[model samples]
Target: MNERVLTPRNRGFLFLDSHPAGCRQLVADMWEACPAPAVPPAGDRPVALVIGSSAGYGLAATLAGLKRAGVRGIGVSFEKGPTARRTATAGWYRTAATADIARAAGRDLVLLNGDAFSDAMKDQVADLVERRFGGRLDHLVYSVAAPRRTDPDTGAVHASVLKPIGRTNRTKTLVFDEEGAPEVREVETAPAEGDDVEQTVAVMGGTDWERWIDHLAGRGLLADGFSTAALSYIGSSLTAAIYRQGTIGAAKAHLEATARVLDERLGRTVGGRAVTSVNGAAVTQSSTAIPGIALYTGLLRGVLGDGLVPPVHQLAALWDQLTGAAPLDLDADGRIRLDGFELADDVQAAVAERWENARTATVADLADLDWFRDEVRRLHGFSVPGIDYTAPVATDVPWPGHTL
Candidate 1:
């Protein structure tokens, strides 16, 4: 692919030949183009830091923290390279938009591109907190979704898998990429090993969550009455075997477990609390890649469209909780169940019935599902409004504060 072809479809230009500088200019231009929105500054206007903050729930969380809570200065840690065949990562384009949004809102935003799991990155965050905002962060949102992680204690790298246990559960999925509409294709299965489960837990679990909190506390970057939360999800039983019961489920369980650890640790401080928001299923780059989920999402989309709650609304609710405007209710496992709408017994039962019957769902039946598909594609800087796709985009765009 041509390097210039990598620029986002919506705004600005990306020159591959000078990727670093181009990315930076793109970010700067986005900042310059932001629209100023009037928002009331509340309670000292805390500094918010978002990890995995480039796209999807992470980006939504960042926006909520700023627009809702009147957070002024922001820091984001995202993983995307300057030049790659895949073009700029969704997070890269999102940061540009986010910076633009913040600037338009008359807020200051700083973005850092790096591994959020690193000590160096943590230190960089701490220094920023100390220097810019007086070592006080009112809200911290952890929204990283990774397929692998290096065990800090063992120094071993673990990769997560997506497979079911016990038997081969074949399922049909709709091929939206085809112009001819939904085509059914049977998906093969793979049995997950014990190591797969364990490694998935290691990679997706709460160890890193704890580390971020610990490092922040140790560095004295945590402000009084600080609130922190992470995102989690649980789909229907149709996906339980592959999702909730498989490697990813193991990791989610670990993530829920980490919330308690963090709460306990942060509670020792003044008015500090850790929370886990169990989010509803939405189309995201990570979620779409999960097997058997696309069909379910499509069907559920149409079913829930009349009364379904969007992820942005859910995130806004989370922000409400963070700012003490709403009560923090915990489930039996001490985690927030924001997916209550989807997890409703009737909802899952309906989807499960469709799954069991193996009915061929058409695009009209899955129109709601397209929202997420479009959003995910937009995250990759494709299919967005206002950009001419025919024009070549430069790949070598300089990202502000992006360190290789």
Candidate 2:
């Protein structure tokens, strides 16, 4: 019986360990708090596949399908299991907990742990769909976020960078000072050099997503009227130079272009559709790692207060659009805009005003640093409510579901 109390270890933007019990509790809370869609999707119980379904927007999309749309789901993610020396990643515990909750609610949500970008993994999922899910997919959601990706065709490994495209980006960002306290400081990210843009697009772009659709569609997997969405973000001008106008932005643009291409192809073949859902900012692991995003989101919390939409709530709205319960609020480029509130004129004006006056000393007044810190801690199963952090818990908790 090996057990110990796991406290969070913060190493800059990373957490060293995750608490199994705390992560379970966090997932349970999210499942309970998620609001059901106004109207469930029509027809029989739908089937969905959510790639990168263990965390962030992917998790939200999974829950939206299972709980709101009454869909039996297959979730694909890459998560490291626990060992004697270290606990599993937060995502491992989250998936396990989600499986438990789904079973209790009489819903089916299968989790598959592996590199979803690989051809082998795609084949595995397609076979599973044939055996267990009626051989058709009603919806497919792509929300993978990773540092690097291996090209399944060329065996080339491409790594993504957070650098600006043409010029060095200097901006005020959140950092831990010498005292290990949150502080506002200016940081400079140098311009991308050489093949940085191409490499970034290779890693985070739409190529893999396109491959997934092609593989599934070729195998006659996508159902009639099927819908697919890939999550994206378009941040404000505050961090645009390092985010929306950076190498990652180029990758996102490629993603949007892929969505358009897929929409046309799917519509022609199966009467299906594909969209890039531009989501709002929230406290996600990927968001916190961006250079200026922590500062910008903190200011969002300070100014917007309760007006800011959480990820799950945004997903509920998305479910409505997907199910025809509401209209698809597409922007000019034919992408869904779930970020309207965050981009509203008044909200941006207030946040911009606060940004200009932000200094280390004045940051407390201008930003919700406590909320920012707590959200980061909460991501790794720390600082959760009603969790006995002092008590020991098992480290090697396996998901009580089939894994490949």
Candidate 3:
């Protein structure tokens, strides 16, 4: 038996456990939030499809479907299984763990690992739902985060790049090294050029989301009066140039636009509802990969502290609201604003003040750097309980009710 304690090897932290115990407090709170509603929704044992349902918001939403609404869920994602050389991606562990929880609660969870942007995956999902889930899925959750995508229609490949859309934006970024010290690194991002917005929109935009919904509708897979939502984000003005007002922002703008079109189409076609929920930003697998996000999240924590909500908490809350008696309110553009607290006037003012004071010498001091770092590790099943780090982890554990 090889003894090992996984440690941060670069910006990509690699420590993990096979059987991870997520935050005890979070698990407790989620149990409380998971409702046994007497008055179920309009459907029978609600059926749901969560695209990209492996990590971050997607994982949270999948949990909500099973634990909160008692919905039978089919989760689709592009995740890898563990190999002899390395542990599987956090998304893989998360999917298997979530399935275990769901099955224990007497709910059903089917996981499909594949390229969601591919037409072949879409066809497989439609066929599976038709054969197994009664050909009617009432909820569609779109929460994909990938660096590149293939256009299912045209076969054109688009890669998403993280670069400022205008004049260079310089700032201090948070980076961790092998020594486990969170250090501030200087970074200068140049303006995007040569069809950056087009390329980014092609990859991260709502095209694939629409294609999924449309193909499902054509196949009669979308149940009448069904609801669909895609997770989105809008944070402090400090990051607007690099985030909200940049290439990614352009892609999100297109997403919001597509939601409007889908909203009307669904409403007219099947009395269905479509929305884009602008969720609060948190440290996740993708957030670490994006330029300038770690600094912003760290600074955000300095101001928001516990006020900021993680995705698991956020998803549970949203599900409670959606299933409760009240109707959902939409902004002028017909988008749900889940990023309310994150965009609050007080929070924004505090983040701005902190951003102004942040520097290489004082960034760690100005922000909740420790929480930011730990949360990133937690996303990958590190800092979890009930694990013997000295023993070799079983990377190829099979999911409950699944043959792998």
Candidate 4:
């Protein structure tokens, strides 16, 4: 077998020669690291449909469902491909690896390589549900995080921007690749208009979640006792001026509202329910790209890592809630605030105290704040145990449902 070294900077390598066996082995390793939950044989294996299943929280959720729920089949939708340089998106490698693992475990994993935002993609998903699982999906996860989405009804395309309101807010940030050093800076932002906020809401918010339900219900693909959920986050109040209180916040607000409508609609189907898992801050590609979030996440990670509440732990908790293993509390707006639990009164109070009073606060302090930074690194497929980093890796890889 050809060998290659995979690094944190390079992220992933794509092998030209399909190493089906090797891929299966790697999948087995990942599966062993995180075993699925056991289910009674008499209980029907739940069918899970995961959109944006390529990476980040979506991938974690998919793995959790596979291990914990004994999910027999999984349908994943992601839009990614090999770059001209022959490097696959991290999602592609993950999908390929996951497929091999599922096949070995006697599970059916169907991947759809298409735009989840388009009507055609919706139709394709419905068709897959009809043909593959006899028209019923027990759980649906809406995890797509796109900056822009075209309006299906209006035939208009909208773009999302991250910016602060009025005056430019300067803050300190952490450079993870730079040994966790603190750097002070001013936030550069794009000019925003009322329409910008509305467009962002329409694109990133809950309309697609509702549409997914509407399509599934219309096609009789939603099984009785079904549940659906979308993930959202309110990172930190410091960044909230640009994030939670800005265009993205508007989108999240819309998303939270849409969940209620979906809950009522799905309630009629199978006592089906709609929920939004407000996730904690982590170092995702989406999260990292946000202007002020890196610093915020870094600080939170440091704080949480010091035996404080971590996002992955919160993710595990969210999974428990979804599996009916635990009860969920919601804010007045009817959104399940996983992050709220992470940022509980005491935790937030401590962080606020540090932010207000820490003199000469340095990068070391931030990195050592909590275990969150380490968890964030792990979330991006880094810093995992027992993986040989020196081994040569392939640059050409294929996910099961991708057709070039």
Candidate 5:
């Protein structure tokens, strides 16, 4: 059973069981709030394959592709279904919502659920593109987040760690109870040592990403002029200790390197281009589990204030790049930076200034804690504005593949 903690305001970890009504409302709100860039009359309608497309950035991107670009898509994920033991994962309900909405609008969608890192899953995707999508995909989006991966080459399990590479780092944040009383606390990251870096790389690195591409290319699944992108993150020096300089950061660095390799390889092999999109740091179920990201994002939300960009917005910017609504605006490293505003000199300066003086007492006044808390709960399909928390929400939500 999954661990769950709920708050009086209906904000907290979503335990076992599906909340279908809440998920449906969440999708509706996301769609309404995040309309895509204008799609020209004759512009390219992407036939896309999205790994991890059931939730977070991937889900948003998939929705935009369907609603704005009117594209058919295959969404692959490894989300759990609800059972007697517990509630269904948010991805399952989100997928159901997406497919239901897409089918109503006559948009074709197929949901593939499994270990995306597996070799068989890669083959499944290639065959899927060949059979259902005419052997070619205009776009392949990788937005997967997982802690562990089993090496198909050797059947070895590798788990990624979220610790500093050289030293332990102390991170402070607040926790709320049902009474809304806030308690200040510190979560520390132990130093990553021995095989931690290598294990983290094996679990989170770009080898699987490359393998996915290699398989697709071998099967002639990548369309001519197809574009592929995997998301990455690079915040400020403040997060460098825990993220940009830690185990995950090492993995990200390797991921970015893999993008360059794929850029050249895809161009040469399939007449396609591959690039990494550096996204802004924000709330997600995964990010909340990390040691320092919550505090960092809380401060970030406070500094950025009114215009804190969610992952969906970054995904929208990515969609814009694909549709010619915006240029790639490649950085010196040839990767896209959707965090341009977040990394701006003024924003960073303001945040750094406040961070120095931010204490437990000052965090609420300094950081946008309410937004951070809401976002954290929202990740678990809680604290949604319109959903009735006390109402009966069915646990069973079937895959939306019937819409295909």
Candidate 6:
């Protein structure tokens, strides 16, 4: 085994290396932090498939289903494994650790590492459902976040961008100065040009979700009352111009529309359901790359304090909804709103005030920059508490489940 005390190699918001031991600790921490279900699940050994299930809300949802809902989960993600010289992706380590945890708890949690948008990947997952999980899919959670996708039919590559739709946006964003201190600065983002919206929707929208459902249904893999949820976000007006009104929002709108279509079709055919669950913003790899989200989430964490709903809690409630233990609190648009606490009137008011007056001098006071920084580091398997960063750890860790 190759051993080294790995440190993070980063450029701005992007991280290039991950610590395997730290990722394991993060997964363990999440398992402990996640709350148990309010009541027992309705189904026995319910089978679930979580796409993008290595990190962020996907990972949380996977753990929630296993620990809180007693699910047999199959997680699919595309992540790079470690080589002799380089460490594996954070998702890779997280998935490996999660598989081990599930084994220790006597739960069934198989993982697949590959391109989820590809037709071959879907076929492989369907086969697993049929052979390994009794040919019944109880839940399908889509939490995929990718910069680009290659269409299986057309073989055309589509790349998604984070930009406003019609107008250029100027927003106060969080940046790190030369001294590595947090600073709030004004950043200008140009509007989406040409087929930017189309490309973004192709990559981030529900077309792939529809394809997954159609494929599974065709294979007769959907169980009775099978439900699917595609994760989305509709933030407050503080980030409306760059988030809810931006190119990514266009994709989310399309996703929600597709959910309606799938919900109707599933209900009509097999008593199933579908929804776009608008989750609360938290520190995730994808969210940090957005223009205003870093600043918005920082302020949100500061204002909400203990009230902020983390992804694991939101997904655990989703498990309740899936298993008849709780009702799905759907909005007028037939979408699940998990971000209610973040969008509370008082919370928004406080955050708005902070947004207006926040500067480098008061950023720490106005926002939870420390938490934000720690969470970002934690995402890449750094800055996790109780982790021995000085000790050499094996970088070549193998996933403890099936890989594609």
Please give, for residues 1-404, the per-residue lDDT of candidate 1 as tens digits.
Answer: 34454433322112222222233333333333332234455556778887877656776677766676667655556656554555555456567656767778777677888778778888888887788778787788889888777766677888978877666666666555324344546787777866887887777888888898888888877888888998988878777877888778888888988898888878887568998989988767687778777777876776677466665567777877787777887888888788888888888777766665554444445445456455445545554555565666655445655321
lDDT of 5 by residue, 1-404 (tens): 23333222344333444466667778878777666546442544568888888877888788877766667868899988877656678788888888887788776788888999999888877877888777788888888789899999999999988889888898665566666555557767789989999999887778888888888888877787788889888888877888889999999988888899999987887677888888887787777766656677788888888678766667877877765567777899988888987898999898888777677677788778888777766666777898777665566666665421
Ranking by lDDT: 6, 2, 5, 3, 1, 4
Whole-model lDDT, model 3: 0.76
lDDT of 2 by residue, 1-404 (tens): 66998887868869889988888888888888788656554677888899999999998888777777777869999999998788899999989988987888777778999999899999999988888888899888899898999999999999999999999999999987545587888999999999999999998989999999999988999999989999999989999999989999999999999999999998999898899999999998888888989999999999988888888888878877776678888989999999998999999999999999999889999988888888888889988899999999988888666643
Model 3: weakest 10-residue lDDT segment is 17-26
Candidate 1 lowest-lDDT run of ten: 11-20
lDDT of 6 by residue, 1-404 (tens): 89998887787778888999899999998898888766665646899999999989999999988888889869999999998778999999999999988998888778999999999999999998888888999999999999999999999999999999898999999987645699889999999999999999999999999999999999999999999999999988989988889989999999999999999999999899999988888899998998878988999999987788878888888878876678878899999888888888898999999999999899999898888888898999999999999999998898775643
- Residue 380, candidate 4: alpha-carbon lDDT: 37
TM-score of each: 0.84, 0.97, 0.90, 0.83, 0.92, 0.97
Backbone clash pairs in model 4 (N, Cα, C under 3 Å; residues 3+ apart or in different chains), count: 25
Give lDDT: candidate 5, residue 174. Answer: 55
The per-prediction CA RMSD against the true structure, in angstroms, equals 5.3, 1.4, 3.0, 4.5, 3.1, 1.4
Candidate 5 lands at a TM-score of: 0.92
Error of 2 at 187 (Å): 0.5
For candidate 4, lDDT tens digit of each residue in 198-280? 88887889988888888888888888878888998876677777888777888888988899888887786578788888887
Q: Which one wins by lDDT: 2 or 6?
A: 6
lDDT of 5: 0.77
Candidate with maximal lDDT: 6
Q: Quantify all predictions' global Cα lDDT against the true fold.
A: 0.69, 0.88, 0.76, 0.66, 0.77, 0.90
lDDT of 3 by residue, 1-404 (tens): 33234543333444543323343223434455555445654556888899988777887888777766767868998876666656566677677777667777887678888899988989988988898888998888899988999877677889987777877877667777666666677678888899888999988889999999988988988887888888888777877877888888888988888888999999999898888988998887777776678888998888888888767667765665555434787888887777887888888888888777777678878899878776776676655445444544545655445431
